[model samples]
Target: MTVLSSSSSRFPYAKGSDGTRRLGYGADYNPEQWPREVWEEDVRLMREAGVNIVSLAIFSWARLQPTAETWEFGWLDDVMDLLHAGGIGVDLATATASPPPWLTAAHPEILPVTASGATVWPGARQHWRPTSPVFRDHALRLVRKLASRYADHPALVAWHVNNELGCHNVYDYSDDAARAFRVWLRRRYEHLDALNHAWATAFWSQRYSDWEQILPPRLAASHPNPTQQLDFKRFSSDALKNHLRAERDILRELTPHTPVTTNFMVMGGTKGMDYADWADEVDFVANDHYVVHGPRDEGARDRDELSFSANLTGALARRRPWFLMEHSTSAVNWQPVNLPKKFGELARDSLLHVAHGADAVCFFQWRQSAAGAEKYHSAMVPHAGADSDVFRSVVELGRTLEALAPLAGSEREPARVAVLFDWDSWWAAEHDSHPTARLDYHTEALAWYAALLRLGVRADVVPAHGTELDGYDLVIAPVLHMVPQTLAKRLTRYVETGGHLVTTYFSGIVDEHDHVWLGGHPGALRELLGIRIEEFGPLADEDTVGVDAGPAGELTGDLWSDRVDVTAPDVEVLARYRTGTYAARPAVTRRAAGRGTAAYVSTRLGVDGLAALLPELLAPAGVTSELPECARGAVEPVVRRDADHRYLFLVNRTDTPVDVPGVEGEVLAGPAVRADGRLSLPPRAVAVLRGPNR
Candidate 1:
């Protein structure tokens, strides 16, 4: 057996007697949904599946707290004892993710209300208003009770704060929300005059004379104030964070030794919670990701969403190994068309996360649900029971995880390039009023990332606000719409100190409050990139213009075009629009400042355009593919290094088998090696190879 050592000293869990940290494998175990007779069977199957950890009591608030005064622990005690006796640890949840129907019935004001004055009824989950004092008090009481009861339990390993906070009711425009929003505004702006200035409330006679009159960004005749809407989003995320902190405090006070975390929905379209802000509150990070199916082509749908999500989650964990808190065993029920994983896809998807930096591989559930909104959702033990192929795959995956136990604490190797992902920018960029309604933040960021993956280059997806830029050789901020002054200075200093930067159109247009920065477009970065945008020319869906790069050839860009003017003599036009009203303007400009270089893109270059342009953009920074010559562009290689070993994860996202030659190493996991020195990865397969650090 190979011994794997961690690069980070902040490993949260203890090591086994063999000096290797076993990779945790389990699912969201809700034994309360089953009979007491079924609980022991669940434990038996868990041990058989090498399930060492299970997240318990995630949505059991109704069962745990039957009424306002009644508290029941007999069933919970039995389940916890059974799990512990079966040698499985528990990520004990506070069960505050959903309040009981009785509680909501007793306190009707706790229900979340939409901007249209529609109350989110109790038929669905996560219907409680985050800002309601009634809800908070009841939630905290239950959390205190759970903590006090289970603080010394042997099964407890970590405290699961709340199930995917703000998943549904992130924003509540009720009177309670209005009150909390006012209090939040008062704390943020200090006075009504400052609030007026920040929100630019002078427009349309909307100037606020009193804080009490201010309301949540509810329905208006026209569009609401953009700044007010932005602040309301901020307050909504903060409100959920406050709830988490309220529960986290109780858990920490009672169980100081146990770590606390909540599952973050870090997929493409999830925008409710700003996870970067939430990451600091957790002891370790965990994320739930499912395949994003859309009107997109099949290949595009399967194009490594899991890897992208896990990489972002790992970056949120500060490059430490984070937990794969929840994913489906096969197809998910929520998408327009739910599709099952093809052969070998389950292991492929699971290992892809491990390749990024997942220490655990868990799922949404242990057993298939017989009823509920997610009855058809896939699970470890599927609807077909223990004899099913899903169960076999689950058992096989558990064995594979045990084989890869030495990789539990390993971290991904530091990358020379990083892609900036900011929630503030996401919120601000996608506002009702923007240059282009078609502008998607994650799509643009993923375009850059997918290009890098195609070139077999590993890149960190970091938040633009709080991340340190000194470590990276090249930084790319795609559609960074909201740029605070501090971040602007940091980027300036980073470029001044010789780090390369690439920012796209609609970037740096506003400050933290969605207030447009004066001077010119691409606000604070105009001086660094040596370009001033006079106006934005948004293209229609059918409209596209050609940008002629000298050697990279003509690239077609759409959605947005900025009329750029070169401010300095040293600013070189790398690409220019070949047609359209802004034909002669620079589509892409590069400038050398002090010892660094900055490139400004004036349009949204789709994936193909970026694939053509990135090589030229990254060449000056001396960033190259880490994969072998034969594997470059064919197999996706992610390198993670420790003191003794270099783990290379090669994932074949294509439909055909890829032969990656000139690779010499011991196959740690995945497909078997060919007769030659090449690694043969089948379609949707993954290869984890370990070798000495070269």
Candidate 2:
């Protein structure tokens, strides 16, 4: 049995040798890839860049254990000792990211199987099956060996269970996965009758008589069972979590003083693992976020999505300081064009994460790799070496972080409005047989966030599960598809107790089991929203709809426009559709319930439309911008509060200089303060201001 540690005790993780807490700054250090002579130079440069910590031996499983019978410790020992001497801490990885070639060769069954039953070979990383006992035993054996060897090493600060748990090999459909899936199902439902009811198996005859008869949602003639696919996703995430626990348990058994964490990829479209559910499993939440290049909007979603993910990560940490495990320093090799970051973007991105409560800001690598699949991936030290622009930016950021060292133990100041994010909704809504197949949960969620940013209103992007909605006056949950009974009641109670809610279309339609609610469309939320719909009117790829809000103005939208009918007498149609079969019908509706109001949007309004609509909703909640009138739309504000003072992070979103007047605070590591008591920021820059918290 695994013993749980008090997460409170692990606060202020990764301290200096003098035991003083400071923001950790470094990257994933793979000194094993470099020669002995290069090792000395690496340490020297790390000190120059103000690097105090690095995640070591992340993908070194093959090197650490050459064969089943052999063990290698001398190289790791030297690297640890060298880092300690260089005044750097190590977040040591378990090296179980991939099995050694010998292990995979001896036991090929350990490899993952696709839904089509094809083997996932070992050319890439994370090829081992999460549920394979053979793989688990060997992995745990290696974990035990490494933990025992480096338990007392001075360089060790934290334990990284695995690298990006479910990046490539999350889903598996082999016999092993089938057996494990069955075990998980039996544990969850406990009875065949309950299982059948939950799965709704009477439709196509997928009901299971025996627990052993059910298999993973593999390739089928038509679309597989929706509930089965949802359960499989849940089971797959759990299986990987189990593997993380296995390695974390060993590390805790040996070194109880050390903290354990796994890097969560909380970026765009990477939705396999539910990080919120796995938050407490670690000592502190650590995330790996990468900005994806956009094609349609010319990368308009890139920065906004980055901020959204970081804010959501902070919410996962419950607003506590967490670790930024990996991000790019410049152009990443994975994208199509691979464009380098624009001037001032490098510091702006890093500081934006810090503003969202990242105490440790690190990247994918310490040095650019000379050879590998990720050789072209940007790093702190690029291929051009220490004299390069990337390294110069690294040094400047290091200096900036040092100046902002007082921000180490601070927590993110709570915003009055919050945008709820749900992995369940993202999973279930986009499942194979969904409406239009063009419904993107992240895109819609980001739309709300980008609107908030454009309005200069600070809104925390928080996970819907286990998060307290009572704290916020206005709660926006976009595309909240999977609403269980408990969640419905909780949201209802929240509104009754004076919390305003704004939800978009296709929300509250399905229960947790993928079964639709028996009532009208927007099923669970229909009564609250005071609007009912019989059917969805999803549009074609080129179709558009005009939403007419009197005096407020007309807005254009696409993708979805539902036929809405007001059910409650008190409900008001805020906007109406001006085009199509539902012409002059309710496009947006609002109803007062108890002490609060509930609002609904019937179409997929892009950023601009959402921005225009948000003002009407926010006006009733009395939400306004903290920024000055001139800097309202162009500046993004994030506040972090310590015991006495608040640190305000102001990020510039434009490409030209912006004058931010009426900012009354002490300037700490950002744009220079002027004699006129105003601050000006260059394009894509960030500024920190300190003031009295009260």
Candidate 3:
């Protein structure tokens, strides 16, 4: 079940083949915004902070071309030369996602049309029509210009196209987009009959007899129709990918050797461009996550701080290291509560990504923001320059990394635990006419992930199709709806061999074709789960039920509750709901198979319930939580080992002191704890604990 055991030192860049230093820093340096004279001082400061890389040309569309049909590269050319002289490599950007304002005005087709029927004007970026041929022609031209200009530059490391795609959701239902979508759909279905079948358009009598009869799913007239909406989402994503594919092809052909990738948005809930598909074309994955110190909803701040970002990046790239493309070094202006990172919090946050598997770490801006939307976001240098406390912290962290290069590229080789998360289930299940709109796939998956994270177990967040169940000792399918048949057979065989399985509600409900697998609930998984879902009880927004006994005790949350009849001979009821007409019904059940067990939870539970359940699951495997009472909002660090050495990651997730046991040296902030055993940690710190293998 072991994946790969390379001497991590050989893979320092996370680019096993690129042979470049993988660990570095990120900053949007618009030297144009700063005087040329300030460039040297900034470079010196960056080098002092252990900064080795810079993502340049972001938001420089206007600077590159102030007017239509004109080009200007004087400022960027100097910036690249200065950074290169300082030993800082650049992630060359195409600046394509955003078009200059004049281009949008000259070609009105570039602007996006909202689902509400209003045409959006230019000012913000990513506002162009993805399918507009004019937009594609114009954008691709600029990408080629940048590629040709910098392709051979010694400072160039990777090619970053645009900044973030789909920053604005949905676009131009103009005649051009409509025309393109018709052709796209025709190509996909080959015939109107097949298209109608996939869309289930037969129910609405919206069948198209001719290819021209199909129109781009727009919000104005045929909007809000679930079938059309889903199609629009799919088409929009494909359209965006087509744009990305065009640029990817250009970069691949021109540069060919240097890796190319774009930063993906955090928790981007299926806007349509499959990152996994994009990952196939690009060399590796890079992502940005900006979680501020504030509450957006009822969820805890820590939820977004660690789990959400981890899940997003983890989902995008499972086997390889993903670059942390951008994060605020201090408070972000966008959040209502712009509280700055308390002492060690930032460093701890950085380590969490590495512990989970980040190849490199960097901040949004090395120097302070001068103007624009992100002007208020914190940076390594405050407007006050080198005198800032934040800058000093950056220096300290840099020194720490300098001391730990010997451990460079080493990864956390974790235990065999696979949690199947799929974007299809996320997109399709939400579009369902189900009884409850609260049945969120990501939330359900996170609930299960949170439980596993607490046990100090390293689990790989993988797609159902990509993972082989035999490689894992435990397979958790959280809210799995669209079960791939090939995946179903693998899971069937795993449980038959007695491997542990923990599944939740709404699993095994649909197949790859988005059709229900009927019999009872869960289709093909019914026999393995050994239960038939008679009915599901939808809990009111404010209502809740508690489970106080079973393998775990005292579980409570407002989730979709269900009633089930156990059919397997070895099944036993572990916990029951404590409310309503269905009170005393089994909420948690476990069944014995050949060499292991299968557990099912019919409703959502609170932290207490998870605390009880995870220990029981890990007990048989002889794994235990190393830091049982990690500081509130702090993530517990996990330690892993091989034949030669033991690796421990001290992930500090809190904005306050998160003291933890056992630390000899760290990649950042040297000698975290003395041998005296007084575990002391700074806020947001990442202490890499290493010692001889036992």
Write down the lDDT of every candidate, Cα atoms only. Answer: 0.85, 0.89, 0.69
Write model 1 residue lDDT over 290-352, tens digit each, in one string: 876666552453455666788888788877778889998998998878989877778878888
Q: List TM-score per model, in order.
A: 0.96, 0.98, 0.90
Tens-place lDDT per residue, model 3, 203-285, is: 65787788787666665443244545556666777777777779888998898887787777664243355555455545666
lDDT of 2 by residue, 15-83 (tens): 556766588899999988889899989999999999989999998988888989888889889999999
Model 3: CA > 4 A from native: 1-22, 170-174, 220-228, 268-273, 292-308, 311-315, 593-596, 617-623, 626-635, 638-646, 654-673, 676-679, 692-694
Can you list the residue pairs that collide in candidate 3? 13-22, 113-172, 344-683, 344-684, 345-683, 345-684, 347-684, 348-684, 348-685
**Clash count, predicted structure 3:** 9
Q: How far is candidate 2 from the true structure (C-alpha RMSD, Å)?
A: 2.4
> Which number leads on TM-score?
2
For model 1, name the residue pairs that clash.
Answer: none
Q: Report lDDT (Cα) of residue 30, candidate 3.
A: 60
Q: Tell me each candidate's RMSD, in Å, in order.
A: 2.9, 2.4, 3.7
Instruction: Provide the clashing-pair count of each candidate structure.
Output: 0, 0, 9
